[model samples]
Target: MFFGSRKGSEHNSGQDKVISMDRFRDGSSLSPIRQAEAYWTALRQGEDVPKRSQIDPRGLENILSQTFILERIAPGIARFRLAGQKLNEMAGMEVRGMPLTAFFTPTARKQVSAALEHMFDAPAVVELSLQTEATRNRPSQEARMLLMPLRSDLGDVSRALGVFVSEGNSMKTSQRFNVTATELRPVTPLLKPKMSPASKSPNEVNAGFAETQAKFSDEPSVMDEARALVEASRQSMDEARKSLSEIGKPTEKTKPSRSSHLRLVVSRD
Candidate 1:
């Protein structure tokens, strides 16, 4: 479920040197947003909300720095359990223990909070279109945010997995994103996967039959090899007895040879 990308490098004058901009793509074209969406979807498998344990950092290596995790502390409130480097760069500080709404502009804070509540309640995925504030030196920058519900170790819907990415230069200072647009997609756990008989493989179908046959088959085959060996042994013993009986019985004896009395008497002399 990994998306392929063609990466190109960009040189900056700041401390961040040799920045690699990877262009991820689906079947259509390169898109980091689509890559994030696909990654989130794969993590869920068939469940509505993926368990926090199911997440592996290596799986999202392409977007590792862009990912973060939030712990829902109360209703309509979530604090960061983990924040990635990309997010910290945007905030210009350590974001751990900070509210998720802290990254949003003041005007968009309420809407973003409401959306966070919906994400936990519906256990759905939320995608946000964000814009950074405009200033004389720094212009307005656009970004995308993806939030998906995650189940905590206590089996509560209080955790969320998220990814945030901006399509501009890295922010040197704290930047708040204004939620210009938001999309909420409802998701439900696949209750029962369709058990299609037509799709069953031959090995799978025979596995049950094999166990059943092994259980009910009590009759053992006759040992033909033993019988054949016993028969051959009996035949050999009969032939031996015949030869012994023949040897014991009287027969026409052959005459002794005339040369039997001859000997070399003076051989050693």
Candidate 2:
């Protein structure tokens, strides 16, 4: 008795269910940042942070151009210990020995400084979303940056491994970026503490299916006891046989006796 458009209803339902999944995909444009973070995480192993000396250029060959190493010279201040060609290109000069704040605009420098301080102090992972101001000749660009804390040879969290990736066309002049967002993630230890023997109970210390009240002793085994019993039985049997033989034979104190009256009886037909 009711008239309805089934096809139209189904089409509307399908349209409503449509969802954008691009955010879940690892896009090519942001591959460098992901690669750098993955490499750092792998190097950490079970430690809070990886050592600076443990970093190898070979491990990050594909993203080497976008990678850089930072050394914390002072609180909230770090300079490029080593920088890649990509960073150099963006700065329009060699970025080594230059402060990381040089890559950011004046307004964003304080935020970057605070983030850097937190990264070295808290020794946490830092990520920054960045953008460039558009001009009449240059278009605005978006970028992502990652900073992972590292320990120096002396075992101090003053070193960092970092990566910078920018999207869209590159500017001919030096391009400074503004910090749009910052993310700080605390690092966790990968290894768990072991339980000491003192912490375990006496029963738990023994590694068997059943518990026994018997104390440990230097006694012989069950096989040894069985062997001893067998030896004693054999000696008793030998003694009995010897006694029978001695009784049957004439002894020094007894005179020889005549043979018994029993005769051998054999029946042959």
Q: Largest lDDT belongs to which candidate?
A: 2
What are the TM-scores, per candidate, against the unseen true structure? 0.60, 0.62
RMSD to native, candidate 2 = 12.0
In model 2, the worst 10-residue window by lDDT is: 11-20
After superposition, the stretches of candidate 2 with alpha carbons farther than 4 Å from their true spots are 1-30, 191-269
For residues 1-269, what per-residue lDDT tens digits would candidate 2 score against the true structure? Answer: 22334455755444434455565553444588887888888898788999999999999887788899999998889999999888888888898999999999999999999999999888799999999898999888889899999999999999999998865346557889999999999888877668775565554445655564355566799999999999999999999999888887865687778887988999996
lDDT of each: 0.80, 0.86
- Highest TM-score scorer: 2
Q: What lDDT is reached at residue 65 by model 1?
A: 80
How far out, in Å, is residue 143 in model 1?
0.7
Model 1 is weakest, by summed lDDT over 10 consecutive residues, at 19-28
